[model samples]
Target: MNWLILVIAGLFEVGFTTCLKLSDNFTNFKWSAGFFICISLSFYLLNKAIQTIPLGTAYAVWTGIGAVGTVLMGIFFYKEPSDFLRLLFIFLLIGSIIGLKIVSE
Candidate 1:
């Protein structure tokens, strides 16, 4: 359940960050609302997850998910760079996240 909460929190973290960019300095009413809601939900779930998961492991996975998700969103949705080296770094980050999870478990 803790892992599940972490995953959900990560997803919401991604959503909130993306929405934050979309909010355009909080001018868009809908985006602003979504951003706030997602941010709150993400943090709440993260707090719940940390109840059982070690702080270091939970934080690592949480940030990893958010980083990867944000980069993907930038590439696919925001027309950002997709250079090979950048993608490789993202994969490396994922590898590190997985390694940490395994070690934690």
Candidate 2:
């Protein structure tokens, strides 16, 4: 259902952020188009999700997914640091997202 849709939207948020990174300040045409497409789908699905889910809860989950995903993408794809504290916080964020899902239910 709607929770699934919300999760998909959150994943699209991930996709858009990755695309944004690859866009290279709009210098890359394909990535730029991907960014726009992903973001649009993300928002559209978010809106659909919010028809049942509370706005604050949905937004929080959405951004949480985006933040965690972007950080992971940075580490895996861009050679960004994955120091102890950074990883710990990422795990914490993931736990919080899960908590929100439980509480929302």
lDDT tens readout by residue for model 1, 1-105 = 899899899999899999999999999999999999999999999999999999989999999999999999999999999999999999999999889878886
Full-model lDDT, candidate 1: 0.94
Q: Which digits, one per residue and each the tens of the lDDT, describe model 2 over residues 65-85?
A: 989998999999999999999
lDDT for every model? 0.94, 0.94
TM-score for candidate 2, residues paired by index: 0.96
lDDT of 2: 0.94
* TM per prediction: 0.97, 0.96
Q: Rate residue 28 of model 2 by lDDT.
A: 100
